[model samples]
Target: MNTPSQLLPPPPRPLLLLILDGFGERKERENNAVHLAHTPNLDSLFARYPSTLLGASGPDVGLPTGQIGNSEVGHLTIGAGRVMHTDICRIDQAITNGSFANSPVLQNLLHQAHNVHRELHIFGLVSDGKVHSALEHLFFLIERAASQAVAVVVHAFLDGRDVPPKSALKYIQALENKLEGKGRIGSISGRYYAMDRDHRWQRIHQAYQAIVHGQGMRFPTAIQGIKASYDTGKTDEFVEPFVVGTYQGVQAEGIGFHFNFRPDRARQLTEALAIQPFNRFPRTPLEHPPFPHYACMTTYDASFGLPIVFPKENPTDIFPEVIARHGLQQLRCAETEKYAHVTYFFNGGREKHFEREERILIPSPTGISTYDQQPAMSAPLIADAVIHAIESDRYDFILANFANPDMVGHTGILQAAIAAVESVDQAIGSIVNAAQAKNGAVIITSDHGNCELMLDAETGQPHTAHTLNPVPFLYIPIPTSHPLPPFRTGGKLCDIAPTLLTILGIEQPPIMTGLSLFVSS
Candidate 1:
């Protein structure tokens, strides 16, 4: 039942794409934060508005079978309105087929290193988290570099968010085992320093000092440093940066290479390493004598790459860029961590700045690593921004992401997650009110599941990882207008873009590849 474009009249209102991060719908109420919380606004929306379940994990989000949904793939699918074969699939395939060693990207970087007579610096998260680069893939790259007679310096960032908290030692030891006598393994730090989305140059500076100057709290060994931090109640992701070997003032001087396919994270570290004559760090007057030549596994941001200069023209165009080309004005609003998810990932891994599109980034609360302390987070601020935009009627569409449930849920704190969901519910109510007042429609969905499935089924302990749960897709109709149409079926998140575009009287681009949820007359 595809709705024909001719039968559709001019939309009576604008549309809002409200993404409640990790707010999935689950029936298991025991320890389920969303179920326990007083989400009156969300409940009201569900009862009144037309809604359906969205398949958010594994194949639904376009990952390999059994792969849990993460922010990178979730947002990419949402904005693309299509199933893009994500980096997770490609990397997994590469590892399985033994093609990673012979990859063109790896070969090109190796060739560049050989031609330039410089050591190849390989940097990335050494974890089994499928969302980011995998430890197996990193090992293969290192082993291949050695075979190719290339001098390689491996900079491994710690991971605790995706994996079990404070499990950095396991990954570090594994890498050490692989790199024993093969290559130099040095400059170990937390993912927080390397994967900063906001302008947290201070964190990046700490990482740089550890990598280039070998300056940090002196640790006799890698294991000791990790254990010391763990003993002090610091998770691996926030542990102070430390060098692997003895701090002998050895800098990794060579062409740098890092494998981060996801566009949303880790740009700050790459920029700090790549940029030459760097003096941005406040505490230390630092300058890289040689501008680090580097290449990512895939160009994360096609619109803008390293050296930190805004490009006059984007190197490539993504979904938002294409939408802008069609004369659609879009407003993207999110907090620091997910700012890239909206701007960079939503735009198809390109950092394009369109005159018509505006981005609003509310800083995630600083000085606190865990989100449970500030359970409400910046939901109200983001909601206010969206409300103001809807009131102004300046943009054709507004996309907002409330990161409370996801952030707080990851902490495995039941009470905080409950409060986080409630906070999001309150914000949703405000956005809906503002939209309805201005004759606008609201479409709310989530990236993936988290707080809804809080406890592990067997263990009954708090589950910290994203779950393979379906999220709610609630559509509140334009104020005072007869319903446009009911969705044909419960669809994937990728279907969201076409649905929104159709509602806004915009043509669905062929590249979108998603079937419209509505049926034709």
Candidate 2:
């Protein structure tokens, strides 16, 4: 039996790590967007190089058991090269142990609201999905607030990307049932309106108008609005803003509490909401003063300006400086939506730019309300950027992410998702060709899976969430002079950092829990 070992190889030429966001492998080829996509380049690479599956979900990636892996958890594990508890796990523990219920932040906010005679408005996702805010946690908070005779209102954003598409009504109704006497559902909107990261002001403006100004498409009930959204052919996540009757009647006065832990999906909306007295509607500025009495679940991005009482520690602090100590020049690029994942989460939640590291951001094409309309989202530009950076020989390492398959796959549009995968494949081909020209090795893998399993096995409907499926990891060596060894087995995301460090002739950090995948005979 072969045991896991830490062995370093001599540093070779330049190397690149390409992360394909939301790309996963599936057994059933039918309805598999990746398999359906025309990915000749990826196929050729898989055949030519050693490839293996990578575990990216649940405990394998440091998430709680049974919890599906997300971009945040996956990237953090890959960057830290260790198994660390994810944000969801932290939240889960807090709620389970009554820490969240009795948290000083919650108590102070509620006390401040009660003393000021202000209504406490809670805004967050209404799903039980762990990626976003959990309904149970929200309910527990509401229950505790109501116990103190504090009137509370909720602005629930529908989440179709993390849950089943078009299932917003089910969650909305369930929430309403729970809040029948304790609280009220003030507004209903899609995550798209409340969670654009690329500074999309229009969506934020619409959500602001609905929640604060009480001016938008008014719906008698959340279910009715969700039904209308389906009739209008909009996915649950992209549905237009709809204000519940109670919200229009009662102003968005008093202390507002935002409950999203992960900020990437909701960074822009949070930024817009921080602006006090938002009157310009669609013309809100990107940067503004923080909203009064507003607090977020975590302070992942301190610059966003929301007062956070429970901030998670950055895992990079525990990570050894392997790449930086080696004096490797690293260049990274990705579209706006995933720029943070490649930099922030991929650096184990570090915000500070590392020395000798360069990052390039390509603005995601705007004007399209939904990603499915423009399935090929900026992959070509990112690919071009990576190719230029690789061939420039200015950097010893290149890291890039193609955000198409993940962004488009969230729409659950079968053909569009396939096209997105194809676009990524073409980008990979360009990168591979560029690496060949520069005599550089390339590591291709994914953060998690979303496009591979296109349908729900039980319901036979389109499933728009990340899966527990394993991701593909392929490594192509430079020089192409010697035959590569057989691929190892049971690779996980954490193994990536150690493997890359080993290839660069750096000592494997003891903090890394994953073993290197490179095995020699």
Candidate 3:
């Protein structure tokens, strides 16, 4: 380690903090973005100071669920000025134990939301794949809401993006289980909505079908009408439903994998027969037949979409804006529009059940732009936001996420990551140019590392999946009338917040961990 430098006075300037997501690290290949980009501006930032990688641990990153490190932890640490270690699983456990208030970090969040009426709306990965939304996090949030008398509304963004498609109800059920019987905590009361329809009513497997279908014969769910649905057009296909597994090889036992939801529920309701199975199934047979099981049951609104904030996005779809204005009166992660992806957000196609994007591998010469999903480019809108933030006098931090890099990288899109990185570089050049005109101190860094720098474990080739490694942080000089920054920020995730507070002329309190490298020696 370098010698501890002499102590110096902190900079007395407003900081322009920019946290880039899924940036940093690159393989040695000649075609990757980090290796190919003509980034003199980035190189110059490197020459200006001491820097190190931020170990963006997916779990440590404090997502409500999941193993990937995304924005939830990155920004919260930067904003809260400390690492509270509020992992999603821990939050889940706390909810189970009814000890959430004991977690000072969560308590602070809820308390703060209560104080600001600043709606604490959580937008995250809703999956038991546990990518982001954990069963416990939602449970505790409800308990906290009920305790503080804060009205709660959940806008669940489904994650067939990571886990199995039909499994959405599993995580949802876990949340429901906790919320059950205990008044309104985690119940079906608050404005509950889901955004991913592709996973809405996914196909279930044989074993799962067996268990859930067994329950269906006894439950007999309430629906307007019901009818037998099968490919009875062909006489051979008209065989009894139990033979569905034999023909389809799905073990079509129980009220299991039915094609439609209305009939599926009708199959699930064992009791709707006026009384017997509904009443007797509950009391009569604990052992005579298979035990009752739930296939997929969740009470979520058909509405909810990612809140959009670009010219392209329909702002009226923002459910949080509605809740804060009319209901609970608080907000979290609410910003006008700085999302790295779509600039203009709408929820129209949210509920359509579609297959997950099939992961494909492309050799070095291939590119994603040449394949499907030109992947909606929010660049123009994001570029506009970056420029506006640079121009704004009160803006202290501007975070812009360029997703194709890391996202495409997950599909092993090497060339695509490189292109994505180049795009990011261009975005940076524009933002810096704008900042220079306004004389703001610009601080740029990425949350975790992915894309251009994949080291495959099997082939040792640059792999596609996210890797655990240190990512590069490029700090450009803010064109302030003041002198240049002597050194750049250092340490790790813990250090980012302190560095910003230093440049902002704010005193770094003890609660605010991480050392500020911007102070002069």
Candidate 4:
């Protein structure tokens, strides 16, 4: 067998890997924000550099076939350098194989609630987004609870970002029909208040008050609560917390199950409900009754000390860990909104930073309800930080995420998305300029697609959800020293880590199954 170092040719030193979040490639011009944006820098790079489109959605990123990719799975696949099974895939497999119904974890929780004559509370986003939580998964849990004769109450978190803006009522009606008096909708709130991961304690406080104490705007039914929010010109995502009909709050000894498998947005609320002496934010006290016993569908945070029904088996020997083992100095930078993607998910779901790895988190735009108002959304600040790092020459490898395209794309505003794309293009131009000054190479790519397809082709309605389109991957060797190897086509997001390793003169670990795009067949 050949030694590890002999597997690939040597590469340029001090590389910069830039991830343009939610940027994708599409041929269609109409309603494509990326196509409409004045992105001369990106246009020039695509024309001049060695570039190829990489598959980012569905089975390409290890999600179920036909499922849209999310930042979590995208970054994880890039780091793992292989098609790793996602939480949704694993859960779906379990459900299909009947293991989910027979899970001891689920059975125990149901039995506990039934024996104690207490309510079983299920909380999660109500959508078919397949990014955070799926409505079908919620339905499965409810059906199981009803089978056990357990009293089930759903604290529905409305979703508009991943679906149509005014579609909450339709989902609510479907849920109501599914319940059919077997269970009840206890509370309704927008994900903006309930699923905040940005340390927006005030938002979390409102959700907590509404879900735990039944202390928000009251409505007799879930449908009325959503319709009232629509009357106020608010979409599903911004619906204020409200209680449904005389539903009492989660009581002591109650069993709580969080159905959101993805961990990022679920972390804060899980912490608030599970941790004792909860000090993350000021919380209203429950004087006599203690907090309910809680379990998550997957591990949100291992430190939270809660049981997980389907715990994630994190991948080993991922890209970052290999770099750390080689004693290479690395830097990870992103705005607050996507900091976890670059660090935690890119590190294979581990929050701990490796040796010789440095992280910088620029504060994302604050005090803004939506990113459309500030479409730039701190990309300039992130670019400045990245350019400064390139100049310092302190890191052998640097990675930064520009969150503009993805965050603003979710707002479903075409003009704002164009601005967001333009902003990232400008930032990429600056970073490339700085890298060239240092004789360094830069690889530009994206986690997934969101801003590319802005409007549905048939309906002409806003297409706020992630698309199945492929993302662009461009490799630029600063100053054009010598002829570089041609990149192979038909690549996937999993091919990125091995490609980066090949370009950095690092050996691809045997655990990684993805081939480097730089290698010819």
- Per-model clash counts, in order, read 6, 0, 35, 0
Identify the candidate with maximal TM-score: 4
**Candidate 3 TM-score over all chains jointly:** 0.48
Count of backbone collisions in candidate 4: 0
Candidates' TM-scores? 0.88, 0.93, 0.48, 0.96
Cα lDDT, model 2, residue 107 = 86
Ranking by TM-score, best first? 4, 2, 1, 3
Clashing pairs in 4: none
In angstroms, the error of model 4 at 474 is 0.2
Please give, for residues 247-355, the per-residue lDDT of candidate 4 as tens digits.
Answer: 8687766578999999999989887776775776665563322345788999999888787889888899899899889888999999999999999999998889999
Using lDDT, rank the candidates from best to worst.
4, 2, 1, 3
Tens-place lDDT digits, model 2, residues 418-512: 99999988888888888878888899999899999788888777888999999999988776566555668998998898778767766676667
For residue 67, model 2's alpha carbon misses the true position, in angstroms, by: 1.9
Which pairs clash in the backbone of model 1?
1-519, 1-520, 2-519, 2-520, 3-519, 3-520
Predicted candidate 1 versus true structure: per-residue lDDT over 1-521, tens digit per residue: 54544444466456788898998888978889999999788887888867888888888877867767888778888888888777667676777777776666667777877776666777888777667776766777787777777777787788776666666787888887887767776677887787766677888888878876778776777888789888997777778788876644333445777775554465667666665545566423344532256667655554334521111122233456566887878899999868878887787665666759999999898878678999999988998888988888888778899999998998888999999999998999898988988878888999998888766667454577788888888878776645456666668988887877777667777777876666676
Candidate 1 has its poorest 10 consecutive residues by lDDT at: 307-316
- Model 1, which residues run further than 4 Å from truth? 1-10, 92-105, 108-119, 247-249, 282-291, 300-328, 455-462, 481-485, 488-490, 519-521
